[model samples]
Structures are given as C-alpha cells and as structure tokens.
Target: MAEAAAKQRSPATPRPVRCIVKLGGAAITNKGELESIDERSLRSACAQLRQAMSGSGDAAPGKVMGMDWSRRPGDPADPAVDTDGFRGMAGLGIDTNFIVVHGAGSFGHFQASRSGVHKGGLHTPLVKAGFVATRISVTSLNQEVVRALAREGIPSIGLSPFACGWSTQQRKLVSANASQIIQSLHAGFVPVLHGDGVLDELLACTILSGDVIIRHLAQLLSPKYVVFLTDVQGVYDRPPTDSNAVLLREIEVDDNGGWSVVKPVLQGNKRGVETSVAAHDTTGGMETKILEAAAIARLGVDVYITKVGTDHSLRALKGDVDTSTDDWLGTVIRSAK
Candidate 1:
C-alpha cells in the first residue's frame, strides 16, 4: 500500500518540448570592458527566459516589450519574481524542457586576445597562460549567470565545453557526450552551456564559439525552436546603424536549395570580416551567428534572431503571433516550404 502511494505521488515523465535559447555576448556584456557583465541586461534576459520556460500561453502587451526592468524593481508583473509566492505558467498546466547557451562576451575575449588563444597550435608560455586565463574568465561568468537564475528560482547547471568536449585538428567536434544534459532536463533542471577554451588535437587549445556550441547542441537535441537573443532586432539588409538599413523579417533556403539574400550578410564581406565584432573578439560575431542559425534552420528547427532584454521576440518564439503572419517582429529562419 505504501509503495502504491509513492508511485501515485511520483511526477510523470515530462514530455520533451525541446527548446534552445542563446543570449548573445553583445546583449549580455559590455564587450569593451575587460570581464564586465551587464547585470541589468543579464537579469532582464533571465526574466524573459523564465517566462518563456513557464509555458505561459499569453504574451504581455507588445508595448512592454523592451520596458526597463531595473527602473521598476518590485513590479508584481516582473518576471524576475521568485517562484515561491509567484505561480508560473507550469502551475497553470503546461510543461517545458529548455537548454540555455550563452556567449563569452567580455569575460574571455580580451584575455584570449592578449593570450593569442585563437591563433591555434602551441605558442610561447605567455600564450599558454592565456588559454588558462580564458577558461577561468568564462567559468566565472557562468557561475554568475547560474546565481542570477537561482535568484529568480530557476534551477540550472552549467556545462562547459572544455570539460565535456573534444575537437579534431580541423576543429571539428570529434566527440561530445550530452547524456548528463538529457538527465538534467528529465530531472527538471535547465542545463546551461557556454563557449570556452577547449583542448584541440593540433592547436593545443582554442576558443570554441558559443554559436558553434548552439548548433552542435541543436543537432544533438533536435530542439523544436532555437532562439537567438542579440543586441539588434534581427538581421538587417545592411548594417543596422546605417540610415537605409531594414531588418530582414525572414530568411530561408529556397526550394532549389539556394540561400537567401541575407546569406551574403551572414558570410560578411569579401574579406569575411564583420565591423560589429568587438576588436578583441576572436570568435566570429554576428556573421557566424547568422550562418549557424541558417544551418540549424535547414535541419528543420525553427530559428529566431531577435533582440535580447525584450519580450517581443520571446513571445513570438512561443507562437504568441503566427510567424506565418506578418505580425511577428523578429526574423524567422526555416526550411523553405
């Protein structure tokens, strides 16, 4: 009788609702400052993340999309409210399984530049020291992120690529086991992954960009949605700061298996260089992000490139507005119908 009662109390195995959220460096950190995190932005992003995971069917009014949370502090509607007293969408009868991957931003980039870690292959002792420092820096940022999520009553564990990944001499992901990640989700905790300095067969050690990590995890997890929250609204026809630039609302490979016009922007210029990438950033910035998004979209996952620190894109991702309709604000990438 006791055993039967325990069985009755056991939580049902959650249905996998595979979703991946990536917070870009520029949106979460002050890239020009060495190792500085934008706490307000981090908090805002985490808030939206929690809301997204809550399985809430309704979107807050679009007017509140980018509303400044810091200024409002204890607003009851604040997504950062602790779950103890605040009921979430899960309690409203929905379940969600999510994974989060965040970029290194100022944490590792400047140190990696000074250390020459991106150059690949073994270098002088100074360069070797940079690899160690880069690891330490990114790990530090990961700890802070987990702590912030905890403040909001979100359970998460940080997974470092350096600890659980291997790359070939060509930097291909040779072997990576994400069994622990799957276990975490089943246990009802969000698994967080980040870009870090990882050992390389020929390079000794190198920076693995978070964007690359997202694509790798998406391929392994086959999430239904891949949401990329960046500093900008979405991919622009030209540089966003340009007077004539307009956001590309959607991008998809054509029926002929051809690329979108946005492909050239994702690939950057003839030199394969992007001006928006921080001077010290060794990882490809917006360019690589778009390229990875396109690749993952072709794999049948809906990919979204949208602004961080806002609810508009997050809501769009959850089907608040039919992406099939023009009401969706962010760019959606999918295989051409």
Candidate 2:
C-alpha cells in the first residue's frame, strides 16, 4: 500500500524533445561592420523559430506575432513564460525545449583579432584590455538576441560564458555547470549562451567558440538535435564562392566517428575546395564547424548545418530531407551509430 501510494503521488515529468540552435555570426551580423547586428535577419530568424516551437503556424498574415522589445518582465505585454502555443506532437504530444547559443561575429571577432585571444592566454595589459572589450562586445550582442527572442514571445534569459564557464589554460572548456540551463528549461524558459572570452588555466584568458560550447552542452544535456545557422546554403564540395563549387547535401559519420561526404553536382570547373578561416573571423570558420558537428554526431546527436535568412532552418528543425528534390535544403550530418 505504501509503495502504491508513493507511485501514485509522484508527479509525471514532462519529457520534452530537447534541441540546441546556434545563430552563426556571419548570418546574423555583417562581419565587415564593427558590432553591427542585422536587425531584419535577427527578427526573421526569431520569428521562424517561434513558429517552429509553437507548432501553431498561427503567425499573423504578413506579420509575425511577437511582443514589443520594450516590454519588461512584469509588463502586460509580456506573455506568461510557460504559456507557449506549442501543441507538440499531435499524436503523442511532447513539448519542445530549445537552448540557444550564438556566435560573436563582428562583435567579438574584430576585438578578438585585435587582442589575439586565440593565440594564447592574456599577458600584456593591452591584450587584457582587448579581452575585456571582446567580452563587452559579445555581451552586448547577447542582449540584442535576448530582446529579439522576447519580441518573438520566446521566454529567454542570457547566460554568459564569461560568468559561468571556464577553460583549460589551452582554452578548452574544462568545467561548467548546467544547473541554470536545467532550471530554466524546467520552468519553460530558453537559456541563451554565446561565444565569449574565458579564463584559461594555462594562458590566463582565451577565446571560446560557440561551436565548442555546443559540443560541451550536447554531451552534458544530450539534446536530440544540434542546428547550426550559417550564411551559406550548407556544406559545399568547395567554398560556394568558387565558380565550380556545389552544395554537399548530407554528411554521415562512420561508427568510428569519421565523416562520409555526399558530393553534390559541380557548378563550374571541378576543383578542390578549401574550408579556410575568413579574413576577419578569428574563430576557425567552416572547418571548425564541420569538425564540431562531427564530434557531436559521435555522441548520437543529429546535426544540421543550414543557411539562415531562409526556410532551410525550419526544414532542418523539422527533420525534413528534401535534398533529392528541387526544394533541397541544408546539410544534415548524421552519426552511423
């Protein structure tokens, strides 16, 4: 009788499908501009995410339904945090839990380059100042992201790595707590994290990439999906800028966690494509992204690398693979395991 009573009294836990979505720097900000954010792109991405999460398809015709950015926590305009429109799986009914991580783009990259944060730890006063500036830049961007999500009626709170994360002296993320994220998710709020300068065990201070953070979070949180929103269509046979480059629709990691590339039709004269870091991007660019995706895929997580500012992001989130058709979308990186 006692055991039966204990079982009956226990509250049922909500088993929501968890997902991690990254807003790439290049997609959301003009890398050429210092600390400049593309408001239109940001807003559109947020709205699409809102639509996907709500599963309502109830966006206002020709306009998205969201709160004004100026609304505060207690304001009437602010919707209840837990009262989202997401109806979940129609047949089995499961809520969706989203965690957002964003890149620094122009904000941190310019400052990182100026400070040489990736070279090693901070030593000189000048380099230390640059580190501080980089943190400030990324933090400011975080605020804008949170505000945008709020306007889209997504309950989100900014979580800064500078405050809660630490890295090895070599700048590898060694330790951190997911309690905040866990608590926020439990309360139906999205926890937003960004790439930022972190204290290094060996160097003093160094830069941490959002991609790295995603890998760490995936291992800890075990999200079902990891979606990367970038400026390009997807992984390409070569850099899409090349005259002969073509989009690679999918990538599969072998049981040994190795990548198997699915080549697309060539656009021009066939040539080897190199994934090099961009001029201003301090973080390793396409190369790092693919490597990170591969690393996470090894852990049994589905990874999507899609272009932002398009319907590709939504398609990836929905697990829709239309690449064989004319309506082909982003690259889906899957694990052999």
- My TM-score estimates for the predictions, one after another, are 0.77, 0.80
Q: Model 1, range 116-232, lDDT digits (tens) per residue?
A: 897775567977888888889999898777766655546778888777663545466555556667677877777888888887777777788888878777766678888888777
TM-score of 2: 0.80
List, residue by residue over 1-337, the lDDT tens digit for candidate 2.
Answer: 2232233321444334368999999888987889899888888788777767766554453333343446555676744443243343232122338889999888988888887876764678778888888889999999999989877767888999778654555776665556666677777778899998888887787888899888877776667788898888877766576765656666767656456654443344222332232211123498788888888887788898888868778776655556567575777787765
Residue 50 of candidate 1: its Cα lDDT? Answer: 62
* Poorly placed runs, candidate 2 (over 4 Å): 1-17, 57-96, 263-284, 322-326
Clashing pairs in 1: 121-203
